[model samples]
Target: MTNNVVIPSRCWCGKGILTYVSKTEENPYRRFFRCEIGLKKKKEQHLFKWVDEALLDEIQRMHE
Candidate 1:
C-alpha cells in the first residue's frame, strides 16, 4: 500500500486525527495516528496510520 500512504489530518467521519503511543507488547511506545471518534466508538472503520511509516512514505515520495 505504499502508493496509497498519505499523512491524514482528518478522518472520513470529519473528526480530527489523534496521535497516540501503542501500549501493546508487540509495539510498545510506537506512535500512530487514528481517528478520534473511531477510537472512542470502536464499532466502525476509521483512519489509522503509523507515524514512522507515513513519514517514510512521504520521504520516498519526495525522492521519487
Candidate 2:
C-alpha cells in the first residue's frame, strides 16, 4: 500500500517536481515555484506559480 498524498508543491505532470527559483527580472528577487522541466522549450502544461500569489489564493479559498 502506498500513500499518494499529492503535495501542494508538486507539478501537475507527475514526473516533474516543482522547484523554487528566484526571479531575475520583472518582480526581481521574488521567488516562485515551477516544474523542473519548465526550463525546457516545449509546448506542455507546466507549473509556474509565484509563491506569494499561490499562498494568497489558498488563503482566499480557505476563507470561503
Index of the highest-TM-score prediction: 1
Candidate 2 per-residue lDDT over residues 1-64, each given as its tens digit: 2222223556667656655668676687786776777668458777776778766776666676
Q: What is the C-alpha lDDT profile of model 1 across 1-64, one tens digit per residue?
A: 3657489999988999999999999999999999998888888999999999999988888888
Q: Score residue 14 of candidate 1 by CA lDDT.
A: 91
Clash pairs of candidate 2? none
Report lDDT per candidate: 0.89, 0.64
lDDT of 2: 0.64
* Regions of candidate 2 where Cα sits further than 4 Å from its true position: 1-7
